[model samples]
Target: MGANFNLKTLTVALAALSAASIASAAGLDRSGQDITAFLQDGVYAEAVYTYLDADVSGYDNAYVGADKNAYQQGNKIDDIAESYDFFRYGVKADINDTFSVGVLYDEPFGAAADYSGDNNFVAQGDRDATINAISGGEVKDFASAANIVGKIQDKVENGGTLTAIEQAQLKKLGPAVAVAQADYNMEGEGTNVEVRTENITAILGAKFGENKEFQVYGGPVAQRVQADVKLRGTAYQAANGYTMNINAGQDYGWLAGIAYSKPEIALKAALTYRSEIDHNLNVSEIFPALAGAIPAAATGMNGEIDITTPKSVNFDFQTGINPTMLATAKVRWVPWSDFEIVPPLYNTGSKADPTNGPDGLSLVSYDKDQWLVELGLAKRLTPALAVTGNIGWDSGAGNPVTSLGPIEGYYSAGLGAKYNLTENWAISAGGKYLWFGDAKGQIPNKFAVSNFEDNDGFALGVKLSYQAKQNFN
Candidate 1:
């Protein structure tokens, strides 16, 4: 029965922590490439449920938030992010002595945030849900405005020659200054953004030749993606009432890998490569200001961004330390630089043409690829109990992170345990903690931000597994 289970507690611990604790790997990465699917034996299935109670403090609207007099020194955005729950299930079967097949259902990538509470981002007194409507055919015009009211204030106070009529305007300068200040602080309450992706993978594997020391596996992966972006606060004043909802879309990719194992001492090593998938997502882009002024198609003009999820490489190894102990390690790399999501027409016609993206500026872009490593130890304490612990590190996707996610890297540690309820059934629990690397989020063409640097996260999970008739001998 023990041999039939073949479950690795370390993998579950890593997955729970990766999904819940690692803020740097938060967006689009829920699983840490755990090989639990392949670890299952004949007619075996397991279900895992995870909950992440994560939040960040000290996040501030990037626009006029820094001006102490306007927003205050301790102007912070708290709990902008709420807790989340995730689940995954999989089954594996042994077809014959040398062949096996498996299937998995999992949420691979997702992101969420809520800023509906009271905050400093909203235009102090102009707390309207929708302000400064930007309609279709005027998207570029609106994006190019670049704080026109503030510019006007500058001219009114610093430059320009005016007559008595203009001099009269000077008397009402207080109101004009207030309006300009409100525009500069557009990042408002109710600003929220969410993205989700799920995957289904079918796998085939075989072990043959020389006492079945070598194993090979490959699979086809299908994924679905959906997202919604809302611009609210004072920092986003120019884009007030702007909402983008991307329709759910499905895409396909492939995975292949090989492994070499020596069961005598429980030594195993494997390497897997996954292909990138392209998605031509259909979306509805709305500019509240131009709701009826422009045709629907013109506002929805966006088939250009073929959202391509990045490819990745995973290598894992484990060796028995003693009759009841094992040492394990893994290395994973993702080319995040090749992945970017920039809504077409959002910032079209760049004032200063960018070298990478022709779409003016990207909604999100990674400056560097990601590299992650893990080291762990697993021990079987008794016939019914087993424990696993691990520590991990991840080189985040970028250095100067974007305001969207301000993590540059992370360090993590986790622990897990499993107890056999019966010979064929087991219950498990795991938890992880992550220390996020400090980062200075920057707004293109604007000043740098430093509020999300000292953030952290935590994750916990539970799982249940069952296996058909098993053979321990």
Candidate 2:
């Protein structure tokens, strides 16, 4: 096969070419659930690093009162820019021609958001509607009374007589002015959440046939989750300073998949399914005003909440256009509607919150499933260099997504490169630009918004691999 048969180059070309993507897809999913590592042909091990940055903007908060329209005008909220870093490691070995085993480690689901920006979304304040309106009204009446008093005083000094009504209005000026000078805004706090997940997969599989081979694999997956949510901001000012901390919980799930390949033409197709993991998380909550209050904390408010991460399926295919060129395609589906983040303590409503949420008291959730697709091509420009490019589309899970995790859909493109430093070592790098589809910024109690459209994201990644020994047989 000459130099045309370098397996190291295949790893580099497919480093960023999984067609399974990361970031801006759906429901805290970053790693696209790729299990292709188990399908590698020989003894292989690699470490990968990825950095993602997302810039989200165009936010609007609905204010409901006589003062609603004026307060939120020009409501271009914070540009939610966040940077995330991730690393993954994997090792696969073929004990013999028809049997293989491997282990993979990665951060499968996560989210980090800091609403601190030019917007008041995270501002520390409690500008109550009732208080602001009452005080503002006082100021309006005070100005009228003061103006009349000033005119009467000037007339009397200039030797002009004043009416009885004018004298009465003058008497009200002092107290009215005091009421007008009162303060309103309290402070902005809360309105944020953080999530993280880790996965470890152990696999065993067998291959059959000599020409177009067939293989099947299955494994147990262990997953862990953690979260911290601060309930403050526009709609949540009612719970303004409340916070919830979900202790990390680890559990087990499973996965199964099958693959077929024609190594000579570099063609392979595979399908995989990942099962859902359920967590009954131990949680602690803090609410400043509710401390030691009647019928609040003494009732086990800091106990547990049930959370379920959704299941998903993946299909991946790749073929060699020629000995030096490759093409690939992939599709994925996730049932995000079944995913939820509900705090049990918050589920019981108070007079402060009459609505328990029509969809349920969710700190994070979606109303629909997610669909994603990707296509790509790779070419070896020389024996030591290879380049690849791909395009992708994601059908968002919901049109009006929650403010906690807001995005509808996205279209993306990426470029990747690999350099073979030696027969045993290789380096790979890639970057992708994602155009977020327009979204109707939604808040529970179902606030409809035409905001959060045309936002964008960027992802960059690199990988290093080592091949200890080769099949020189």
What lDDT tens digits, residue by residue, belong to model 1 across residues 1-473? 12422334323222232222222363356566455557544567878788876656565643332332232233566666567777877889887768888888877677777665455334344423212221111213222333443454577678776666444433233223332334345434465778888888888999877787788999999989998876554444334445678889999998888988766566778899888989988866654333223344224544445688878888888776666677778888888887777665445422223532544666667778888887887778776777788788888877566555667767888887777788677777878887877665544323343356577787787878776644433
Worst 10 residues of 1 by lDDT: 130-139
Window of ten residues with lowest summed lDDT in model 2: 177-186
Per-residue accuracy of model 2 over 369-446 as CA lDDT, tens digit each? 888898998888887788889999988889688766677878999988888789768788888899987776554445
Residue-level lDDT for 436 in candidate 1: 78
Evaluate model 1: give its lDDT: 0.62
| Top model number, lDDT | 2
Cα shift from native, residue 194, model 2 (Å): 1.0
Question: What lDDT score belongs to each candidate, Candidate 1 first?
Answer: 0.62, 0.68
RMSD score of candidate 1 (Å): 7.8
Clashing pairs for model 2 are 123-188, 124-187, 124-188, 125-187, 125-188, 126-187, 191-232
lDDT against true structure, model 2: 0.68
